[model samples]
Target: MNIPNLLSTMRLILSPTIIWLFLRDQTLMGYIIFGLAALTDILDGFIARKYNVRTKLGTVLDPLADKVLALSVLFTLAMKEIIPYWIPGILAVKEMIMVAGGLFLWNKGVVIPANIFGKVATASTYAAVLGSYVDRTIGLYGLILTVALSIVALFSYGRIFFKEKV
Candidate 1:
């Protein structure tokens, strides 16, 4: 695997570990590990784009890794009563729709790259997860922003999918 792909795979693997740490009441450890995993997401994308080493696997795996990590963290936080359950619930449903749409587009030989809105949403989500460790209010606001941006991203993706599919 290329460096970018490897990084994405590492994030995917680290996700469950982060969740485990959070579940075990290891917030500090979980936060540190989660930060590292989030860094991989940024690094992998940068490497892939800058080096022009983007692959179909990287294209798919990168976002998949982000989704898994973000969703898992949100779910874990909710389960721990650190965040509202509806936050993760809404995000889970949104992600499921995104995955299904992405799969359909992939079958049709169309690959839609992540847009700015989606990037911001993912970043905000990471911030929210991190902020939750510090202050619940900050986390709540961050998640609210994430949900809004994610909805915009979903619409943007849907627009692109239709435009390309047609």
Candidate 2:
């Protein structure tokens, strides 16, 4: 596998480790692992773009890794009583919708690339989850922002997808 694909795989591998650490009440260690995983995400995208090594596998695995990591972190935080259930719950619904939409479009022989709204939503999710480890207030705000961004992303992607079908 290429460096980008490898980095994405590493992030996927790291997801459960971070979740386990958090579940064990070792948030500090979890945060470190989470940071490393985030770093790998950034590095993978950069390396993929810079080296022209983006593969179909990388395209699928990169976002899959991100979703797994983010969902695991959010679920862990919610389970630890660090955040409210609705935060992850809503995000989970949004993710499910996005996945279904993506699959629908894929079945139609269309590929919808990640847009800025989705990226902002993802970053907001990361901020929310990470901030919860430090301060609940910041986490709440971040979660709210993530929800808003996710809505916008959903709308944006839906519009783009439907428009392409015409």
Candidate 3:
């Protein structure tokens, strides 16, 4: 309902459309839509923080939107042979582990916020996705960088949540 949440919702809605375009070989349109969705991601966070209209819904929807957008594009590109499977595979596994870890922590009444490493990984993934349209080499390097950052993020989150318990 709020502006921030609405923006997040827009990104969510746009995810499948972007994927559809990509799968259909509409690279330009896919990239444009993806860029717009990314813009919404930035705007939603800024608006939520600046206008003090942050909501729990926004908190949940924003990350969900980000995951859907990033993963969808990656999968589509991999399917089209535009990017290697290993890249999305690594990113996907990292995300799965992170989600499982988050759930475990939540069950134990711990809340771990997204850290800088995760943000860096996400930004790298976005770059990789965009770069695929320009040059596969750029995309490949970006994905490699993202995978590295994701590993660090996994370790960072694990350290944060498991340090006290272990």
Candidate 4:
């Protein structure tokens, strides 16, 4: 019950709340929840590192929560036609590819701890999707940032691919 795990659980709980708020068209509440969730996202990492409380569960759950929250929001927004149709498609596809690769590596016994670039991409995605819930037009910059961060994350994975013996 460290701060990191608590924050991760908070995010997990927030996901369905966000979806319900979005479904009810309660855009402002959705934004509030999303922002709080994002703040917890930042706080969790700092708490984990600051307190030396990092756990394997936190390491795994934090990123999975991020992906689920973000991808779900993107899908919800796309379904509402609030943003470009292709944005979610591209992000989801890339996410799936990376996730599959990660699972493959893990099956072969490599933990592949999360990297800085992945955190950046997750933050940008939360920002972009939350922005869409408020003003749908406020998406371009976040989208661009997501792509930039994704590139960095992919490069890190590339290094693992090139260097890992397995």
Give Cα-based local distance difference scores for all models: 0.93, 0.85, 0.83, 0.79
Candidate 4 residue 114 C-alpha distance from true site, Å:
1.9
In candidate 1, what residue range of length 10 has the lowest lDDT sum?
Answer: 108-117
For 8-28, candidate 3 gives per-residue lDDT tens digits of 999999999998888888889
RMSD of each: 0.7, 1.4, 1.8, 1.9
On the 0 to 100 scale, the lDDT of residue 26 in model 1 is 92
Q: TM-score: which candidate is best?
A: 1
After TM-score superposition, what is the CA distance of residue 133 in candidate 3 from its true location, in Å? 1.1
lDDT of 2 by residue, 50-98 (tens): 9999887787788888888988888888898888888778878878987
Candidate 1 ranges with C-alpha deviation above 4 Å: none
Model 3: which residue pairs collide?
none
lDDT of prediction 3: 0.83
TM-score of 2: 0.93
**lDDT score, candidate 4, position 144:** 62
Winner on TM-score between 3 and 4 is 3
Query: Model 3, residue 135: what's the lDDT?
Result: 93
Against the true structure, candidate 3 reaches a TM-score of: 0.90
Runs in model 3 deviating more than 4 A are 163-166
